[model samples]
Target: MLFLTIYPKLHVVFALVSTHMADEDATTTKLRDRSHIDNTLRLTTAEPTPEFSAALKKLQNIYHSAIKPLETAYKYNELRTHEVTDGEITSKPMVLFLGPWSVGKSSMINYLLGIHDTPQQLYTGAEPTTSEYTVVMHGEKSRTVEGIVMAADNSRSFSPLEKFGQGFLERLVGIEMPHKLLERVTLVDTPGIIENRKQQERGYPYSEVCQWFIDRADLIFLMFDPTKLDVGGELATLFKQMKGRESQIRIILNKADNLATQDLMRVYGALFWSMAPLINATEPPRVYVSSFWPSEYAADTNRQLFIQEEVSLLEDLNQVIENQLENKIAFIRQHAIRVRIHALLVDRYLHTYHEKLGWFSDPHEVFEDIVSDPDKFYIFKSILAKTNVSKFDLPDKEAYQDFFGINPPSGFKQLSSHCSWTSGCLIDNIEKVISVELPALLSSLGKKETPPPAKATPAPPPPLPETKPKNRWRKD
Candidate 1:
């Protein structure tokens, strides 16, 4: 009897493991083949200003020809897997909405998309209704594209999101329509955060997916219903993850019509207090108090305030559209610097190992040596100092360790033979793109009368190009 019971349990476990492995294999096959039925070229349909388009195209050319090769050869792609595609740089500004269930995330999206009618574009309700990550974009006619098909397409920026696995892809969809606002900006609506759901319950990496969107988004709206002010579970985790990105976040006290003026004040105060620990910012994030749904304002006394707040929010969105090119350029410059640092650090790590163990030694031996010695960080510090790169620009320690821990460093070993800190021409090419090309691109984008307040500490403006510049970049 003991043998029989134990054998059955073992068989069940084996079956589950097999099913998981099979699921992974299927996901791998689907991605490798890129044979989704709707896998057609996804060209950008939204029309940006002609000048903006020309400048962005030029920057994209420079990036692919000059920066991408260095990033790929130095394994910077492995560190930050999201390759900057042309679509990503040229696409409309993305405004991402994230918040708890029944908080009006979808409703706000619909309101902005001008889909105010009986049948909403995205399902909305008091309970959890939106169960997918939806990207609403501009198109001639309204249509929905499946996530698997969208993810498989190289033209879209979402290919990087495929790493989240089939579970996330299935929950991702693109809703295209001929909306006026979408012509200027893209809106990403994420699934509502639930209070107590575990990662297994969700069946995907929720925070990681959110972080991916957060990192790329020009504006992030963290909407909240007046009824539920407590931030716990997934919502709290997200707030914590958004530490460095405080500038992008705009807190929305949605459905403010539900509260009277006195109650609204109390609720807003309470919400800020609850969030203070998580946000840890010097001041509370800008909270726009408004009810997004059409029906909410009809019966509410605070209709005027809501309208003013909504207008303010819309103006901010418009600013995002105006600043999109500059934002893209800013992001590209930051990414290039980070990639350069990543490449240089990887080169140094490998060179040190090559000197110690020579080419024949196991790569793991160097990784182990680094892991064993905490003092080895000083060596990296020295490299950063010499390069005038901040130590903070380095990749996350855990991620760096995991990469070197799992992957054989033979490729890096080969890279070290030719790509040392001082000798590599690729470094010079990348720097030229940074110091010369990008700033020139920025200048070509004629100065806006009053540019929006920068989302982060502004990158120091690149220095003027040298008179006798090295012809490091490709002529074309």
Candidate 2:
């Protein structure tokens, strides 16, 4: 038997014991049990400090007091922007996994979280196994919630997905597990991308749905199979849509064990060359080569490299947890800026319409014309130039077309005459949040919270004394 104890500044002792048996199986079981207990203790004992909790509360208050109202009054929700919800404010950091079929997206989730007592909540196979998007989160017990129910549930942040239509909602699901790591981060497993599949075949706007998740995800892993380095078809479209999100993306060349060390180098180079035209960044995104699932690569020469890369990736995930609060505030700040721009443009459109034609002119026709040829519209051009905002900063024209296309013309008429930006304090409040409130809150957080020190790569533990093998064991 072995006992380990750790003591902190107060001299309080936390002790754990592991019993060894002559049977190797029993010893392994004991080790696994000890690891599970250690993880639980760490999760339970490490409560957020009072200062951090208070900071979060203040962040929420800033959103409710300043940002949310601007969005509501300006009808930001009617625009391309996603409406922020309370569930998103309180949710954990989200990590999104994206790749083509059989690229091991689901397997990677299992590897990171299902190693302990949690059975694999996701299905994995050589073919397209995951047909729907699954959100793996923490809860008291294991259960599955259908997409319709999940989106309807006010406690979850999935309500925005409802806009994707009934076809998409039918394919979404939520899986809950009482796992230790999930308490720190949420994992989203997306349906694998298939080559030559048309958007019409999917019964929804696939690229648009992906863009929505991409905008909200804290980190995105673009997994690739070495055998399928060709980024043709939908994958190319997906990569192009990820423009300006280079910092959040990490490319993973999964299933590297299948190739020899030299082959891996050639495959990696090929992968980079293929991704160059699609990725809009000047520098290539970080690429990690490894097989995520538990498997033996004893004969492979890149085993050591795989171990190091895995550690680096795991560290990145830990960093996400540490910076969760900061990321949320930053997201809100950016959203506020976008809403401000949208409000200004809408106000400009309405004011121009009121000026050109007298009070009772058909505002709906004016709005339609503006949406159709925003670039040629003298008012839009003047507004962009005067405000020093780029044409790219404007909301998606297609999104506006679709929304107004389905709804009545009455909505556009209402929006045109209301002119929230000029009629109320919405613009002033949002500007204050973007300039003063958000910065002050972020500065206070920096003073209250100290970042954890960089973790050094741990030296490998000494190998167990040589003994005849009693049984073949797989790593958990």
Candidate 3:
């Protein structure tokens, strides 16, 4: 009996040891992979155009000096920080290709990269071939990297995807190619949407991952072929999520050369009819019909259609680089609006708290009383503590002091001046940065005029003096 117990315990210990060894090995591999990816990113990152570089710098300055300070003050740091980083505005435009498996997504990519004559840079087949999301970017030499490397590269923007679970981590692939086209655009090819119930049960957060990409992609190509014209299941869900991004989405009807004119029209009609409800748009998305690569079965008429469609798609993609600054400005403007609203609420709270305490009646007397006995202001602190500010939207208390021009009381003069200055400066900064300057910059870049910002109402006039006698008990 003693021997049996000892043997089982020994076995358990050995199993634990083996698992630890495996974990260590995995960690070591991930570190090595991360180093390799970082080096590759350094080599592949292209220099931004002068116009884009200048715009990015101006935006970064505004973010760090104005927006970031306000957000840090109100504790709203979590709001849209991912969209603009020091380097994000200058990074290359991302183009994402989303579609069902074997819909010629990869083949079209190969053709664009001029790798069609060489061994396929991306795996293509009639059945599902790509089992991972592949990100192809410019490099001096061709290389393949794993997802961990992407997470490790701080210069790249994919770190957020790491939270999608290990399944997603395991299924991400990064391809570095020397194609000239990649210098202007970063292309992402996702694993075709899985329709099988059993496959979907594998716990990959497909829709969530796709939504992340959609949020960052400057242009999204939703590819379809004759074989899979109807969108359903996960694909339909993905389309529904893309409702507001219609301007960024382009529907590509691929492999049209395989059908005759009559058959092609039927397929086109079928696709449009089926996708109408799924897209849920005022007008149908632009559908670019093309046979991206030469097909042995393609007819002369099909070839003509492919040429026209391919030219249009390429032209649209080329315009993305020029529009990068415009996109960044738009992103910043949206976030700025949110910050302004948050500041407004914080200012309102401060104003109300002061009014309730009757501090506005005789500011000098109130300041003297509070300074003489700091403990007497416990109600003010308590009110702030009890306020139901959302954790995500909370502003910094110190920021409120700065906005209101309240310096820590060195003497009586500073204390008395508190609440004397209105929050007009904060409001003015928001309007100037987001409304006036941003719109002017956009127009200078020859981009369309952004809608004018809603005019901010000035802070309510300070409360009128009360004739009632003061309550002395509240004052220490």
Q: How accurate is candidate 2 locally (lDDT)?
A: 0.71
**Alpha-carbon runs more than 4 Å astray in model 2:** 1-46, 115-120, 359-377, 385-388, 396-424, 451-476
Instruction: Write candidate 3's Cα lDDT for 1-476 as tens digits.
Output: 68657799786667557744743443244110112111222223335546655777887777776676566555444333333444455567899999887677887787566565465368766656787889988788888878987866767767667767788888898888776567767899988876654546646877778888898888999998884565768777888879778888988888776577888888989998888878877877888887665233223565544554565566566556557777878877777766766555444444444554573566655544544443344523543453332344444444444433443222112112222254335445665777678887778777433323325433332222333222221111
Residue 447 lDDT in model 2?
70
Model 3 residue pairs with clashes = 73-395, 73-396, 74-394, 74-395, 74-396, 75-394, 75-395
- Compared with the true structure, what per-residue lDDT tens digits does model 1 show for residues 1-476? 68658799786667557744643443234111111101111112223546766787888888886788787787676766556765687677899999988788987776565474535367766557788999998889888989988888778878778889999999999988876677777899988888888877777888888888998999999998876775887788998878878878899999787678999999998898788878877766778898775443445466556655665566566556667788888899888888777777677666666567757777677667864452465546755686447767766656667667655566664433444555466777788888889988888776434323334443332232334222111121
RMSD of 2: 13.1
- What's the TM for model 2? 0.79
Give the higher-TM-score candidate: 1 or 3.
1
Model 1: runs farther than 4 Å from truth? 1-47, 118-120, 358-378, 413-424, 448-476
Position 131, candidate 2: lDDT = 73
RMSD of 1: 15.2
**TM-score per candidate:** 0.79, 0.79, 0.65
State the lDDT of candidate 2 residue by residue for 1-476, as single tens digits: 12322434223222111111211232133221122222322433445678778878888887887777667755678777467887888888899999998788987787677443246447766656777899998888888879998788777878788888899998888888787778878899999998887788888778888998898888899999896676887888888778878878888999886688888899999988877878888767878898776444446457666655665566566666767888899988888888777767666655655565547767677767766765666655665775436677666657656655664343333233433555346667777888889888888877764434325433332232344212111111
